[model samples]
Target: MTSTDRPLQALLAAHPADLPVPAVREALLQCVQPLTEREQVPLAQALGRVLAEDVVSPVDVPPHDNAAMDGYAFAGASLRPGEALRLRVVPHTVLAGGPAAARLGAGECVRIMTGAVMPEGADTVVPHERVQIEGSTLHLPADTVAPGSHRRCRGEDLRAGHSALPTGLTIGPAALGLLASLGLDRVPVVRRMRVACLSTGNELLEPGAPARPGAIYDSNRHTLRALLTRLGAEVIDLGVVPDEPAAIEAAFRRAAREADAILTSGGVGAGDADHTRQLMQRLGQVAFCHLAMRPGRPFAAGVLPAGDTAAARAPTCLFGLPGNPVAAMVSFLMIVRPALQRLMGATPQVPLPVPAHCTAALKKRPGRTEYLRALVQRQADGRLTATPAEHQGSGVLRSMLEANALIVLAHDQGPVAAGDSVDVLLFDGLL
Candidate 1:
């Protein structure tokens, strides 16, 4: 082993096996750190990338004091209590994007359009519908309009020289608009994370191939790719590999060289043909091969050497998921997602569980945590109720299809009775 691989060796030695969900999450997160690679990209291409540094606004968002809507601009000091106010209309109309209007004379008001710059010496606005206009005179009833109403002050949206977007924030649609409003052409964002994914098992075949006895189509890679893509990762799709140790080792070496992290589905169980667990033991430092969780119990994580002496790249993180389809997806959502976020220089966010009433009875053991496929519905009274899917088997991918959320049963919790409250992880914002 190289000198760079020593830290992971120590980490693996210190970690225990068959950890609980929270312990496993904490341990894996503690092992990996964020990458420092960043680049300047055009605002159009920066969507979904993490900000490397805080973006300070060079100018105020609105840039100038402007009208929030079509209105008449005048000094608020002219109004008298419980008395009608009358003012002569200025001849010029202040249009948005047009030149600024000349200063208003006493008892004079200017017609303004939405987003139009407020004329000089104006501090209030009265909308057209709220006032009466007679020829060149503008009339307003007492107490009908308030001072500074309908005027959008400069820097009200965002002040100049303030942090427009903080570091580590993901650039979404709203962020894009904010950057555009600040007149920023380019932004510095952390580089896209590289993740390599593949499937193993001799019984697996591609989708287009002819049906064969005892063979199943490989769906894990496609599912993994979609998950990685949604998280703004650059996925390296290493297609299906047989259960041979030589082929598996070659795939691992290639992934370690090209990607920052590696994800493998299948061959993590203790079967004789489970070469993934064996290869992970041989090629990487194994943190843990099992977790006290249902559906995805056979999970593995550690650091793999890049094995490229010339480039001397840092070790790659590995996540060995189960062969079952539902288990693989659940494992990705519950554990692997946040770790990958940390590696991308973004803050790790774990989905919080909300209390929901369970509509059906659930039988669960006391030693392990269980995540049940559930359909969560908001009741008429605004409370949420969760119903477990008919099929809860790990291989039942349809269970995941019918579920919009997962009912999280704690490790020490026992069988749940009908109408009992349970913690649920909603998939609305998570997926």
Candidate 2:
């Protein structure tokens, strides 16, 4: 039977191991999509790009043994309590990145600065405040330190040929610093994936336009575009298409040719005007449709075969989300985001669900899972409490704006009383 022909529970029971969140994640990972090849990018432009290969240190991080402090480098064995030792300060003194100077001997010392390479035969460093400099001669206090006390040994931070960053690491500020420390001017990173976004509805108009009678402004297109762009995808806006199969088919064909993934908001339900599902089935293989979750129930995913025969058969993925603004966004976050991450050759995706106590009663059906819009606040006792928004309808987009989390009510769960513990799916940057 088709996905829509069976109940959600029956569908899940058919593939028990692949319907849960973790199982769905693993199934997507098992697909044979290749990661885009690496390109050499300047260090300044590599932030947020995934590393294509492991980065090994070409040379020692410090490169040479140096002083960790500004002090006098001398033989510690020659020092005696209450006794003073004096020696001439070596000319052309060593500084950081400078050549090492003459070796220090018994009863002799060399004036050294922080990060300066320790001279041969000098094993201990006495702080500058502990010594009295008279012209070129340096006077050291009676007490001396043990050997190698203040020397920074080479390869302390990173040794040559050591792996500094593994493959699949998302490059960030700290990773860039490590690359700089390894003396790399360029880094190899995966090429950014291109995503196309569109909104489908006859009654939808662009924001700021004079609303025609019975028409609403489209907000899902902008929201999905922003979310996709933030994930490093090159987003292309296809604008809006009416509820016509021909128009949707054309858009789908164009998206298949030009984009790695196509995200369309609306037109995947049971209504006659919902043509996205029909067009998707005609163009690609529909993997699944209709999940067991509320606010995002009418979802669909598929893959369109590329036209080229000689080139490897690459499939462009598609996500048909619900028509309601909140449902479209929720479906995108829960399903489409992970699929995009997989296409980009990143590590496996995992959804983070934080626990919170419900401050008010939550009423819901027993079969379908519900994601209630909630404003999470930290209580005086340091515990997080979720207060449900006033408007819980799927079509009410205003309520979603004020919500920071989706307080999840599991399948088969009945009405929850006040103070009930629940799992909350926090939106990005909300927590």
User: If scored against the real structure, what TM-score would every candidate get?
Assistant: 0.93, 0.79
Computed on alpha carbons, the lDDT of every model, listed in order, comes to 0.86, 0.76
Worst 10 residues of 2 by lDDT: 1-10
lDDT digits (tens) for residues 1-431 of candidate 2 = 11232233344567643244334434444442646666989999998788888999999978887888988787666666677677667654668778887776556677788999888877778788777888888876565455567888889989999999988787879999999999999999888887889988788899888979999888889989988877778898999888888898888778878778888877776664677777787787765555667787766666776556413536776777887878887777766677677677666454568889999987777766778999898999999999999998888989888998889887678899899888988876421
TM-score (C-alpha) between model 1 and the true structure: 0.93
Candidate 1: where is the Cα deviation over 4 Å?
1-17
lDDT of 1 by residue, 25-69 (tens): 766677787878899999899999999999999999798989988
Report how far off residue 305 is in candidate 1 (Å).
1.1
The residue pairs in collision within model 2 are: none
The true-structure Cα RMSD of candidate 2 reads 5.1
Clashing pairs in 1: none
The CA lDDT at 21 in model 2 is 37
Question: In angstroms, how far off is 17's CA in candidate 1?
Answer: 6.0
